[model samples]
Target chain A: MNVLPRRQFIGQCCAAVGATGMMSALSALRATAAAASIPSGNNLPGTEADVASDYRALVCIFLNGGNDASNLIVPYDASGYAAYASARTALALPQSTLLPILPKTSDGRSFALHPSTGELKNLFEGGKLAILANVGTLVEPTTVAQYKAQSVKLPPQLFSHNDQQAQWQSSIPDQPFKTGWGGRMADLVNSLNTNSAVSMSMTLNGVNSFQVGNLISQLSVQPASASSPKGGPVAFARTTGGNNPNRYQTQKDLFTSPQSNLFSSAFGTLSSNAIGNSDALAAALAATGTIATSFPDTSLGNQLKSIAYLISAAGTLKLKRQVFFARIGGWDTHADQVEADVSLGAHAGLLQQVSQAMNAFYNATIELGCANQVTTFTASDFGRTFTSNGDGSDHGWGGHHLVLGGAVKGGDIYGRMPSPVVNGPDDTGLGRWIPTTSVDEYGATLARWFGVSDTNLPVAFPNIGRFAKPNLGFLG
Target chain B: MKPATIYLAVAAGFLLLLLVLRPDAGVATDPRSPRIAAPPAPPASAAPALAASPVASEERSPLADGLNAPAGTVDEDLRIVATLIEVFRSNFPRDGNPTGSNAEITAALTGRNRLRLALVPPDHPALNARGELCDRWGTPFFFHSESRVQTEIRSAGPDRKHWTEDDVVTKQ
Candidate 1:
């Protein structure tokens, strides 16, 4: 009997208002609207209270500082290994140390995971994780010859850190950064929720470029800490007290006040909504039972635990759809790529953290019984140079990424794998590769599975039309 | 002479003739050989002259651009320009930030011969019309001297536009 102590129980009560409170608020509001629209005399079909029956979530795990993915997914076959080693020089992983995985496509070409990727290997072998090869920001479908010739327009800011990361989320590198695909998707489908005031997109990280939309800004929350406003109605949003009810009511009035200025009015409305959402979500999470799966104490692990709590509360909150964002930084390994033994270093540590955290998150989804309804994917700024600059590699384009869920077609690699040919057909010169698969194709596939219609797919991904295949077919 | 002795002598003479002639060597005069000559080696000409350098030119000259290209290519002409830029940046003040003018910085180098040899290479393009260091697309590299310990170096990228998507700047 593992009994939660009194202080620990109080701490859990304080932490009950998890990340996706805004989604729940919106759902509640939408359900209210549906109920209101029904006529008193004539009994029309009222708002379906069970909209939560078809709950789904999309989680985007962004690896900051441009994760060097050339080493993440490696070639295991003899000929492939030789080419990779020759090109990478000192930075290549030893063939003997790699963890080989049986890919579905057995064309005499096999691949192995990074030595630190044992957890991810288990997920792959268990048919729950799929690898998307050589994917990156692209304006249109580009060929090697066209890229070299500059015949087709290329993605903007090919290697700049901020710009490339922005493009990975925004999908329009040439233009300015204002909105991201996640926010756009939320804008397109958020109306389906009965609640209109709360946004469907939520972030554990503070503010980000990924969830910025024209109309719907994502709700922000800290995974381990409360919102902790300096002095607002939401500061004690989830707290129940009657000592100074006037101060709380005064703050609430300030939040709901309609200022003459447009911006002030909007801010007031948003503040009021935040307070309302905090109170409701706190009650719902308090009533929800604990999850059986335990996550690590790492930052990403804590973020995933918070997301699991939010997913479990989906039924209570009446949320039909949701998108959550979580991230971890410091993957930029320009120095000290590995120790002399070639076993552990900064990059390997990041890989191990990602593997363990993702594995645990998947287990949590299964525990919640929504494993098939939710999907998780990885995104990065860009791949790193295959060539080593003595100690480490430089920033590059076109990287391999991971897609994991129960609905994913696992044990396979989607898209064309770029040949590890430095200065050969695939390389530009210093081991930077042009992506064979575009971001449009990747995002469209995920959006399609998220219940987006073909016609409205462009709302989420504007340039989806340029690519021939919007869906990459990884989803079931 | 006996018939056997005559036949052995004839065979020996034929072997010696074959060795001396060497018909398979593929000399043009040997009618039995193929007509074409061997493939040419990659040209490694000396750097172009100083006066003809792009820095001295009235108009910006366009060179090839492959600064960020991957390896395994035979026709990448712009790598030399990128390599030279890397070397030039390495020659900055010890603290990695330079406040002095280009001439002052060039003179302060401890190793003068290394800079002199690289500053002017024959047949090596990448000199803009202003005779300054630029990328293959004629985009000039700007050296902003704001900080005392560090100077900003950036190249106007492929579109010949400044501060756009294709700009390549030094890591701060």
Candidate 2:
């Protein structure tokens, strides 16, 4: 592998910080010291050559942009199917293109998927994937009339992307919050670990609002590669003083300087932490062994592959708990959503890639013997409207999401499926359905099953108390 | 007293003390840590009125407090525009993509108190795709995009002195 240059790495850091403007002279000195102190081989806590492994992790795949779910998981019953077809218009997937439906006895209901998701069908039938329908941000249990009359509060900027995305991740639609439900859940269970080499939260997609914690920050890693400050060892080693080592010494001196302000101190601390975490991650990666599972080579696939690689290395990291964040975009299909194959194109194509990769990842987890210990779930900003906006659907509230793993009560749909009519009882003026189940309820159930105590549930999900029941009964 | 009998009696007493102390020593604390003092709980009565004025507590959210300035002050307007800069840098296809580290960015912003640089015109190269002006915490201000120029304006007009919350605030 080609090594990243030291000067280039410093330049990138400079630019990143430069986005707001250049850092002070003192900050540069501290950063250099932190960079030099990065841990070397065998220095981390868990990688002592050999160790036994038994741990579990959850990987969350967030599909950004309000994913049009009406076309993703369709109603298969005769009446419901017809209503969906009528409302969706140009956006509807023909019955012929849908993945085969698995009829369930509980609600006398059956569902189909866009033909692109044939791989997903196999997993569902094999009892790996469970669907949750009509879920969105809610402060409390609300009705359409109540929503229209403003009797109860709703999430801020209901149809906007950034607002709703933060709301979904934080479970606090009332404002923009950094602590996601996942990060908060990590906060509760993070202290249980014996190893301090790795953090509870890791993100392949980069720094996100969802992975932030009050005290602990998420570690950002590259997909399928070692993570550092961009440029290689030499770049990191090159400092500002006369000799290579001089820069590091200068930086250390600056951080420890009594004259330094609180801001300077904080900058020194964070930069040092970043370098420390990166070095630890590199060491952990070096000590990992390969797994037999093969993931698809797509972007999402590469991300899952990294996640799998990390899980395979869990022994070396000495982690009892971990949360991985992965994301796939391009779901904002405004026009010509049909694929080149016609039946297997656009939105359908994206779903197929999602299903195939997930199924493969699930199988890999099983092969690794951590299948039951690992749970994978999906989340999105909001669901698209039931009615098609010419070629695609517009942004709407309350779309369906999926959860997959050996531990999930799979092979069925949870939550009330909204009527697929243009102006049904659940509709709020337009075709957007009011969510019967809050995002808080859905997240709380998962967090509960993941080992978060009932007492800590409110902290992970503040709005959970506003709902009648916290758990959605998805975990088996 | 017989020496062997005295020793056995002392050992028995020590064992009893150990057994009595062990249970209390091993007792579990509340399995969950007490909540970090969050801002006082939202009022039950106020819950119903959230729809009327939606953003009553937007400033208090962790994202707002940790990442950007609270959204009302001139500092906030500049910070909002900087968000667009962050987004543009993240979205740039060929310049080598990075997710933009929030911590590092935050440090960079705080290091140089450039929190009120929004008075500068949009034409400056510093406002370009990769080098956009950020708030004190390195949050790139959010703005609507129209080609290269981000459509967000910090001030209402040339004066920028009279801008209010009701003024047109661009969304990314």
How does model 2 score by TM-score?
A: 0.65
Predictions' DockQ, in order: 0.02, 0.02
Model 1: docking quality category: incorrect
What range of 10 consecutive residues in model 1 chain A has the weakest lDDT sum?
A226-235
- C-alpha lDDT of candidate 1 relative to the true structure: 0.62
Candidate 2 stretches greater than 4 Å from native? A1-54, A103-105, A176-178, A225-273, A339-341, B1-172
lDDT of each: 0.62, 0.59
User: lDDT: which candidate is best?
Assistant: 1
lDDT of 2 by residue, A84-127 (tens): 87887767667776776673535776678777777777777878
DockQ-based CAPRI category assigned to the predicted complex of candidate 2:
incorrect
lDDT of 2: 0.59
